[model samples]
Target: MIYFSLQTPSIPTLEETQAVVQEVHQDLQQLKPNAILETIRSWTPGLLSFSYRLLYAAIIIIIGNRIAFYLRRFLKRTFDRMGMDLGLSKFLISLANAIAYAIVIFMALEKIGIPSTSIIALLGSATLAIGLSLQESLGNFAGGILILVMRPFGIHDYIVSEGVEGKVLNIGLVYTTLLTVDNRRITIPNGTLSNAVITNVTAQEKRRIDLTIGISYSSDLKKAKAILERIYREDPQILQDEPITVYVDQLADSSVILGSRGWAATEDYWAARWRIIEKTKLEFDDAGIEIPYNQMDVNIFQKTIDK
Candidate 1:
């Protein structure tokens, strides 16, 4: 390898450093006189300008909020016009307003130069978590929606479901409230109700009232049937289109069971049933129709003693 000569650059002298510093100071002084802050102050308007800008921004926000409210109101009105359930319509309106407010807030955030993208991501994550946690509630809500849409029963309709019989008082998002004939309040979960068998007693305009009358085995069957038929004929509430049925259904140990069925308006079902029972008792008493009772006999055998 051939040897080469190396040289180092010489450092600046003290006097040369002082000259550089002086030049930098002079430049800063020259730039400071024409700074942007002083120029902005010279061009600034009075307080009225600031107030106007603030008022304009406020008006924009107010308009946006009011628009959201009106839109929600319109949606609610439309649902009401369609004869939808009050609970469902109110829930939907609240949901719509919430969504509209969220959108308005996002737009306002953008106006203020806040990063809304991250907020949207956070909201999406939160919504997903909440939905997962409320899965069963959502399912029940859907079931309620189906109930209202399908209209299996209406208010004050007598319905039997989940081994309970009652009148439907109101239908809600998660459950259906009922008033039983015994003056009891029952709440059935929509999820269970939707899946179970539902018997709507008041779906039809008329229903059949079934009554069984038991008489003494020795009584005349023809006479008992005739008495029942006469009572049904006298009751004006009893429907004529569907004729009353009366026949000997079964022979019990103590009496002959007579089955009687008659049609009546659904609204008058209970009254009709009571009337039939009362009339049956009165007629049977007048005709000396003995309604038999169950009787049991016991025989005892004693051992004979011979002395």
Candidate 2:
């Protein structure tokens, strides 16, 4: 059998390294600027090609911008024809223009020779990051969109939601503003309002007024009901088409509670309600009907034995 020896190369000492560096420095004197000139010469042919691409991209961007404007106008007209809210229509138009411009920008970028796939990836990542950070705001924004589109309630409509009762003043992107009966303004997040139990009082043409009154047990139930019904009939604002309902709803410890329901035009609901409340007391007084109150009798036993 023959044995083969494998020898390792020895490392260069300091002197050998210095000598190599000196030799490289001497060779640098003979080198020219040919490498830079060659690079510029090689790129000269592509310059015209790149310039043309840039010019084409510019033209595309300009034409796309004009198209975006035209689309905005067309969308506005379409939305108006479809009976969309005016403010919402404007917002949608602006959004459409933004999307159009973004698409044009990406196309232009691709024409300029940048890879569109990489740009889209970068945009997607950025959008994901922004979306995570703005989840709550985005939810409110989405809720606003739903409200605008569905129109659950409109401006000046009286609504009750989340234990707050008020007239809607403005419906904005992130929040809804209301004016309370006392004329104080309050704003609620659209997200919360969208999920809440919304009671729109004036959504219908006619409104119902409910009033409750109490009288002594001795008073005639039939007469009391008749008086309430008459009051509802007398009110001009109260809609006569719908039937008025009055009944002895409950016999409480203090009095017989009569519940009255009357229908009125939406605009006259408050007037009818106030009139009924005021006239009930006057009618009962004239009829000598007593409105009962809580009373307790304390009988003191004679303390003669103790005395």
Candidate 3:
């Protein structure tokens, strides 16, 4: 009997449902203005801080530039007195200045509320990727440092390496510049130069000049040697302390080649060799010694007619 008129609870009408949704929306709208005001109030301090940070960054940049410039100039004068190459000096000073500026910039960013530690950690994590991407550049950088330390060759020194021969014009951060005798400029990577076989032709004060003279088999070997020795002796450019050696070195089908080695000042090596060559020829002509050439003897006669 109690359940006889139990009605199924009626679902709300569409109108009622819509009215509830409208009420909820109005409440949200009323809260939005205050939320917006609170948001702006919170951002005010941040905006003011941002402005100060910008000003500080500008100051840091200006001061950093001046400090970098001053350090570079000071290092330049010091390096010049130490006989450092101009190229090397510039690289070192610029590197120091760059590091100084980088620190200042990072500090300014920190002052602006950026987390410097987090930035550094992120950079450290990415280092391997960066290095892998720039492997050649990193290698060249290391090679430059090695070159500076080893001092294998300096500017204006004539050197041959990696199949290239020239006078070093400049040693840059990544490459070395060379000027060939024909006036061709070559840029060689420092990484390659650091590992290549280097021949410094003018590193020493004295160098040996080698000259070869060929004479006929009938010519007196002893007489030719004597003339060469005398010629080398008379040349003032030849180093007197070092012994000059002249001997029959090779016998070709046509003539006997005399190998002579004489020591001379590095600057005078070519001149001494040329002078000795000319003098040797004159002495041979005067002494009636024949400088032989290749000639073939033929006996062709009646056999050709018979054919």
Candidate that scores best on TM-score: 2
After superposing candidate 3 on the true structure, give the runs of residues whose Cα lies further than 4 Å from its correct spot: 1-82, 96-115, 125-134, 250-254, 301-307
Query: What lDDT score is found at residue 192 in candidate 1?
Result: 83
What lDDT tens digits, residue by residue, belong to model 3 across residues 13-113? Answer: 99999999999999999999999999999999989989988899889888888988888889888998988766677778878987898788788888788
* Model 2 lDDT per residue over 1-307, tens place: 9999999999999999999999998777446466667888999989989999999999999999899988988998899789988878988888888899989999999999998899899999999999999999999999999999899999999999978989999999899999999999999999999989999998999988989888998988888888889998998888888988998889798899999998888988887788889999999888878888778899988766754
- Clashing pairs in model 3, backbone N/Cα/C closer than 3 A: none
Q: After superposition, how far is residue 96 of candidate 1 from its true place, in Å?
A: 3.1
At residue 18, what lDDT does model 3 achieve?
Answer: 100
- Give per-residue CA lDDT, model 1, range 1-307, as digits (tens): 9999999999999999999999999999988887866777776775556666556556767888999888988998798789987877788788888888887777766655567898999989998999999999988888898898778888888999868999999998889999998999999888888888999999999989899989998788899999999898889899988878998999988889999999999999989999999999999989989998767789999998999
What TM-score does model 2 achieve against the real structure? 0.78
Q: Output the better candidate (1/2) by lDDT.
A: 2
Error of 2 at 196 (Å): 1.7
Worst 10 residues of 1 by lDDT: 46-55
RMSD of each: 9.6, 11.9, 9.7
Stretch of 10 with least lDDT, candidate 2? 27-36
